[model samples]
Target: MAKKGHSEEQILRALRQAEGGTRVADICREHGISEATYYIWKKKYSGLGLSELRELRQLREENSKLKHLVADLSLDRHILQEIVQNKAVRPRHRRELGRWTQAVFALSTRRVSGLMMLNRATMNYQSRRDPQHALRTRMRELAASRVRFGYRRLTVMLRREGWKVNAKRIYRLYTEDGLAVRTKVRKKIARRARVPALRATRPNERWSMDFVAARLIDGRWFRVLTVVDQFTRECVLLLADSSLTGQKVASALSQVIAERGAPMSITVDNGIEFASKAMDAWAYQYGVQLNFIRPGRPVENGYIESFNGRLRDECLNVEVFFALIDVRDKLERWRRDYNQVRPHGALSDSAPAVFAAQWTDTAVPGPEPVPDRTGKPAAGNSLEILT
Candidate 1:
C-alpha cells in the first residue's frame, strides 16, 4: 500500500479532489483505480505537497533498516545468556582470560566458535526439523472427524492429548488445510405474492374460520369449529362434537347470519369441509364471498390460527374431559369469558364483546340464546346437532 506504483503527483491530485467534496465513485472511475486504493492514497498524502510525501518514504525506509539491526542485537544477547547459565566454558578459557575468551560476542561465526573453544560446525548448525509437522497431522484428523470443531476447540483437544500446541499454531494449520467452518446460507423461500392477509376495514367485513380438535373421556376425538370476526377479534361461534358435517356447518353459519347478518367475505383454507357443496350453496344463497387460502400455507389464516392456539393452551391443555357434557360446559364458560372478559390487545385492550358492542347497530343481529336442556337430549345426541 505504501508503494502504490502510481506517481506521487497523481496520488496527491486525487486526494485534493476528494477533500474538495467530489464523491469517491466519480474519483475512482476517472482514475481507473479501486475505491479502496483511492482511499489508501488519500489517507497517505492528505494536505501534503509532493516533496513532503517523498521525504516520508525515505524516512520509512530508514526505520525498517534500523529494525533489522535491532533484531541482530537481540540474537547476540541470547547467546551470551546461554553460555553464562550453562557454565559450559572450556578449562583453556579459564587458564587464559578466565570467561572473556569463552564469551560469545558479535564476531564472525568462525571467530566466535574459536573464542568460545567450541567447534565451528556447532556455531553454524541449523534446525531443519519442522516442530508442527505432527501437530498438522493430528489437526487434520480432528477436522475430518468433527467438522464443527473450530481452531480453539482443536487447541484444547490437542493439549489434552499431551501435545504442547497453542491456538495460534492450530489456526495456522487450520487455514493450511482450507478448513474454515462454513457459514450457514439462508435460502430464500419461493414466495409469489398472494394477496396480503385481508385486514377487515370494519366489523363483519372479513371473518377467519378454522377447526381445532380435542378428545373426550372415552377417547373419542371431537372437532371444534371456531369462527372469528377479524375486525373486532371476536369469537362469533364455537361448535364442538364427535363430528361436524358440511350441512351442520351451513346451518351454524345460517344462524350467525340471521343474527348478525353475513360477513362481506369469509377467509378459510382449502379444506374439504370448507369446499363442500353445502358451504358453496350457503355462500351463494347469502351472497357472501368464500376466500380460501392456498394449500399448505396456514399463516394466511393467522387470526383463526392465533385464536385456536390460545384456546388449546388455556382450555384444552388444562381440563380433563369426562364427557361431551363437561367439554360443552367448560367451552361455553371459556368462550363467554373470551368474548366478554378477556381484553384483546388488537382492540385497544378491550374485550371482543365490548369492542363489538360499539358497532352493534351496524352488525347484523346476533343469534338468540337457545333454551336450557331440562329434558332428554336432542335428536342425534351429538353436540353438533344440539344447537
Candidate 2:
C-alpha cells in the first residue's frame, strides 16, 4: 500500500496545533489527512520537536539497515555451516547442498544458489547421457581378459570391433569404471654417447634376434627365441622349447628365411647361441651379415629387446605354461595377435601386419660417408644407425 506523503515536520506541526486547541476535524481538513491518521501519528510521535523528529527518523533508518545486515549475516552463516557439514568440493556435491538448503531455509533456487555459491544451471542439471551399459560391459570384459591393456590400446580394440568411439571418451569411461592398468616405474639411467644402430628401410632389410626365458607351472624353465623385423615391427618368429641350442636357433632362422626371404643383415647380442659356429655357418650359407652388438650392450639390438619385453609383459608374465606343447600353442596365438591385432604406437597405432601391408618401399638415399681425419671420404660403407 502507498504511504501518505506527510513530512515529519508537517506531522509534528499538525500535532502541535491540535495540542494548542485546534479542532481535530479542522486540523485533518487543513492537512488533507484523516482524523484517524492524525491521531495515529500523534500516538507514535507525540511531544517531539522537528530536530528530535529528524533524529528519531535517522535512528529508525539505522536500525532497519542493521536488521538487513543481520539477516545477510545469518544467511552466510547457514551457507558456511552447510559447507562444513557436507564438505562439498565437486559441483555435483554442491548441487546436493543446494537442494538441502532450499528445503531447510525455504529459499528460492536463485537465492539458494547465491547463498551456496553454486551455479543455478548446475543445480538444475540432469544427465541425459547414455549409461552405455553394453559398451561398459564389453570394456570390462576386455579389461578382465587383457589385464595389461591401457585405455588407449583398449580404444583401438573397440574400434576394431566396430565401435564408433574415440580414445578420449574411452579414457573417461575407462577411468570412471576403474579399468586403468598400473604401470611400473623404472629407474632412470645416465645416458652415454654411443654408436647408433642401422635402421631398416623395408621389411626383411634387417632383423633383430634375442632370447627370453620363462618357467613352466612345473618349475621347468624354457627359452624363447624371438626374431623381429625392424622395419615392420613384426614378430617374425617365436620359438619356445625346454632348451634351445645354436642349431635350433639356426633351424628356426632357416625356416623364417624360407618363408619371408633372408634379411640383408641380422642384429644380435653377443649371446652364446648367437655367437656360436652354427649361427655363423647359417649366416654364411644365406649370405647375410651378422652384426653382433658389443657385449652387455643390448640397446644395439633394440628391436628384439623391445619385442621380448612385450612378449614377457603381455603373454609370458600373464600365462602359466604346463608343457612344451602348451607353451608353443600359447606363443603361437600371442604372436598372431601381436602381428595382426595389437596396435603399435610407433606404427601410427597400426598393427604390424596391417602396417606392413600398407607400406610402400620407396627407395631412400643412403647417408653420406663419414670423413677421415684428413677430411677425405672413407672408402667403406657409411655407418647409418637407428636412434
Candidate 3:
C-alpha cells in the first residue's frame, strides 16, 4: 500500500477519537493506517489540542531555519579567521587570498568575495597595461648604480634621460620591484631655541666648510675637507689627504676662489685648522669674513654639515680607499657627479650645476656705479665689500 500524508488536524482528530474510547485497531482500519502508526500518533499527539499541535509544527520549522543560519555564520567566521591570519590588507593581497579561499574551501567566487570584504569585479580584474620590462630593467640598473637614491631622485634622473614618468608611477614600480633604499633613523635631541642661520640670496654670497674623516684599507685615517657654496648647493672643493693642515686648507680655499671668485663670508666650526693663523691670514688677504660657530655647536654651520653627512653616507661609506691617491680620485669623481648629475631637492630636483646655469641665464645685470670726484675708487666700492 502507498504511504499516506496526514495533516496535523487529521492526526490530532484521529488521536482524540482513540482517546475518547474508540478502539485503536478500529481507528487504524478506518484511517487506512497500521495499528503501529496509530499507537505512534497517539503517543505523540494524544494530549495536545489543535492549537498546541499547530504551535509544535511551527516551532519545528523555525528550529530548522535557525540551524541553517548558524551553519552559514560558522562558515563565514572560519573564512574571516583565515583572512586575518594571512594579514591581507592591500587589494592585490586580498584578491590573492580570495582565490586561495575559493580553491581550499571549494567555495564560489561570490561567497569568497563576500567573506573577504572584496569586490567581485576587483577580485577578477586583469590588467591590460604593458609589463614595462624595459622601464623596470632600466630602473633596476639606476638603483644598483646609485644605491642611496630614492624614487624621487630616480624619477628626476629618468626625466633627464628622456623618460616620461612621474614620481607616483616610479614609486609604485619602486615598491613592486623592491628597489627601496633603506635609511637609518637618527636619534632626536630636544634643545632650546636657536637663532636661524642666514639664507643665501646669490651664488658665491656665502660658503660653508667642514671636514670628514675615514680610514684606509691599511687602517690609516685620512681627512676630507669639503667646501660647499651655500647658495648654489655646489660642492666647490673636496680635498682628501692623510692630514689637512691650516696651510693646506688655505691653499684649497685659494684654488676654489680662483675658479669661482671669492664668497662674501665663510661659515666654519671652531676647529684647529679653521682657527689657525694661516687661515686667518688667508681670510684677511681675501677680505672674506670668517664666521666661526660657537664651540660644540655644529648647527651654526648647518649647510656644510648637511653636505658632509650626505658625502659620508653616499660616497665615503660605500667606497674603500687603499691610498691617498685613490681617495682623491674617488672624491673628485663623486664631487663632479654630485655637482653635475645628482639631483638636489633644494634645487627643485635639478642638479647644482644645472640650477646655477639656469640662474645665470635669467639673472639681470646691475646698474653701473657713479664716478667719484677724487679720481680714486670710493671707499667700500670694491667688489670684496660689495659682495
Candidate 4:
C-alpha cells in the first residue's frame, strides 16, 4: 500500500483535538498515526482551521486545472505549427515561412570564402550604396554651425534644405557620431568661517542685492542696483542710481519693505555700500540677517550674477538710456516679463511665475516673527519685526 499523507481536514481535526487538552499519545492512536507524525502535523497545521482547510482544497483544484491548461496549450501549439506548415494556408503564410527558412540558413552558415552568402561584407556594401552620405554630411555641418542642435532639429533643417531624410535615422547618426554634450555638474560650496547657513524655502524668504555697472549708449557710466528673491528668482527691486551710498541703499530697502514686506535675510557682496554701518543698522533694525559672499569669488552670488547678465542682454542691451526714468521703466518692464513669462531652462523650462505658483503654503514651515510698530498684536499674516 502507498504511504498515506495527512489530508488537510485530518490535520486540522487533530490540531483542534490537541488544543482542547487531548493527549498527543491518545490523539495519535485515535488518528492511527505515530507520535512523531502527530508532532509533525501539529507543527505544520496547528494554526489552521476549517476555513483554511477549505481554501487549501480550492487552491489545489485551481493548481490542477492550471497544469491541465498548460499541457493543452503545448499540444495546441504543435497543432498550429503543423497547420501553418501545411500548403492549405494563405500564400502570405508560405512566403513568410520561406523568408524564415532563408534567414535561418543565412545565420547558420560559416561562409568560407563567400560563395554568395548574406554576410557582414554584403551588409556593409548595401549600407555604402544607400546614397545618403552627402545628406548625413550636410546634417552634421548644420548641427555644428548651431551652438548645439538635437537630431530632430537637425532633421528639420535638413528637410528644409531638401534632404528628405527620416528624423530617426538622423538621431541614430547623431548619437553614433558622439555629438551629445554632458551637462555641467554644479557643486555646493562649503562654509568655512562658521557663518550660519541661511535657510529660505519661500518667495521673499531671503533677498540678495548687488550692483552691476554698465555704460550708456552715450558712454556715460552708471550702476544698476538689483535686488533678487533668493527662493523664487524674482526681482524684488531694481534702480539706476548714479551714486549709490549706504544711506541710499537703506532708503531703497525701506521703500521695498513698505511695498513687499521685509525679507528674512539679505545676501550681498563685500561692496563698501553693503558693508556700511548705516546699511547694517537698517538691516538689524528690521531683524534681517546680513550675509556677504566670499571675497573675490563672483560666482558665490551666482543667481544674481546670472540675473544681471540677462538684464543687460535682454533690456539694457537694446536701448540708449539718457535719463534714470527711462532706465527705470525698461528695467521694471524687463523684470516683470522675466518673473512672469521668460522660461528658465535651468528650472526645467518653467517660468518664475509658474514655478512660484507651485509653492503651496504647506511647503513652508512657518512665517518668521516680526513686531508691530505700535507694540500691539498685528492682524493675521503680518509678522512682527523685532529689533
> lDDT: which candidate is best?
3
Using Cα atoms with residue i matched to residue i, what is each candidate's TM-score against the true structure? 0.44, 0.64, 0.70, 0.46
Clashing pairs in 4: 370-383, 370-384, 370-385, 371-384, 371-385
Candidate 1 positional error at 94, Å: 68
List ranges where model 4 is wrong by over 4 Å.
Answer: 1-199, 360-387
Q: Rank order by lDDT, top first?
A: 3, 2, 1, 4
Q: What shift in Å separates residue 335 of candidate 2 from its native position after superposition?
A: 0.6
Please tell me which predicted candidate would have the highest TM-score against the true structure. Answer: 3
Candidate lDDT (C-alpha), each: 0.74, 0.84, 0.85, 0.68
Error of 3 at 162 (Å): 1.4
Residue 234, candidate 1: Cα error in Å is 0.5
For model 3, state the Cα shift of residue 204 in Å.
1.0
Candidate 1 least-lDDT 10 residues? 378-387
The digit string of per-residue lDDT tens for model 1 on 311-376 reads: 886688678888877888888888997898665657765678888777554444334423223232
lDDT string, candidate 2, 280-301, tens digits: 8887777678898888888777
Task: Name the better of 1 and 3 by lDDT.
Answer: 3
Candidate 3 backbone clash number: 0
Model 1 bad stretches (over 4 Å):
1-194, 359-387
